[model samples]
Target: MEKFKKRWEITQDWQLLFPLIGIIALAYTSYKISNAVISKFGVIAKVLLAVALFFILLRFTLFLFKKLENKWILDQKWEMIRVFIVFAITGSSSMFVGRPVIKLLGITKENLNVFIYWILFIIIGLVFYQILLVFFGFLFGQFRFFWEFEKKMLKRFGLGKFVN
Candidate 1:
């Protein structure tokens, strides 16, 4: 039992442990939900579903980055880099899902307004990230909630003294 507890503690200390698990969980859950909805309604439904999923996933990824920055795991400049990474992930995922969407809509990529659409998507994603920061700022009154939350957690673990 002691050894097991020790292992758990070590696992938790690994920087990206919980987050990587969360990313996998989110991807799997999104996949299942998307497919279930698509089957129930058909390809026409998947179009709206895909767009909604993309927005929600993008929002959540932004939220995660905010939390990470709050924890000081990433600095302000690094936060910008993280945003680009999230954009890349969402952009690529959209392209993969979108090819089929375009086909279902009886539209060809070459015939579509690709630049305008992607620019709009990128703008919205950026706006969402900004909203996340504003929301977190309002919620915590400037200090990051996760930082304070972690502090409290450390106190619970009798690690508070060491933390400060």
Candidate 2:
């Protein structure tokens, strides 16, 4: 535990939650991807594939950590993990929440052109993504980081005036 904390630069107990959540989220994502790729396979196959993907993803994430370490402004190295987790949750959740919203608005492929429905879906997802990014960042104790991120994003979208 000491080594783990030292490696992550974590001094507080609550900061430990980020690593634990990162592992669980990564494992769950790995399993979901494995199942999608091998729907007809048995449990053993899925488990093995998930394990392979987990390690691959872990390696890729580490690579990203090294690459992003200097690019992003952060006080602690452990905060990078928290920022990533917030991004992961916000991205997945935006789509999940957008589905119900699209349905409620009676938006469907059968009702509209396939292309239009998809376009609307993407737009709605983006809106939710923006909102959820800040929301989850606050929940994860990175509100300032994500708020600044959101402002930049809005600026890129030509909504900078609103942010100001």
Candidate 3:
């Protein structure tokens, strides 16, 4: 029991962790809701729509901090946000790219129309996915900038060694 308590104190930050947990829960709920909508509307059509919305949300959240004033920035905070943004961008784009390819291969077992639709889906998804890649690349570059900025700030404030 003592060991468990010690481990929990070492790793847990409930205030921070809860918000992340909430966001994850919300995202999962949104996905489930969107998936249901997609299945009802047309599997491919709903999926494409959800993908578009997800990318838009990801892009907006990723860049939202850029609009903040200089005084409002925090090194660790910005790093976390940037990391999440990159993860979202990378994950969404990977899904967008991978899903259609897999589906295309699967469709080849069924019918030519399925293959054609898969090709169309891939082509369309690739267009948006490639755009997302560019955006993600831009964010990755920005992360480097922020990382350097954080280091410089820490150094300037004489808290350099305190930062990790």
- Candidate with best TM-score: 2
lDDT of 2 by residue, 37-115 (tens): 9999999999999999999999999999999999989999999999999999898999999999999999999999999
Query: Candidate 1 lDDT, tens digit per residue, 41-94?
Result: 776676567667856986887776566655544333233333334434444455
Q: Cα RMSDs of all predictions? A: 15.9, 1.1, 15.9
Candidate 3 C-alpha lDDT tens digits along 47-143: 6766666666656754654555253443444344444555466557766676767575564535568678667666666545544554674655554
Residue pairs in clash, model 1: none
Work out the TM-score per prediction. 0.29, 0.95, 0.28
Q: List, in order, the clash count of every candidate structure.
A: 0, 0, 0
- Taking all chains together, the TM-score of candidate 2 against the true structure is 0.95
What's the lDDT for all of these models? 0.52, 0.95, 0.56
lDDT of 1: 0.52
Q: Best to worst by TM-score, what's the order?
A: 2, 1, 3
Error of 2 at 145 (Å): 0.2
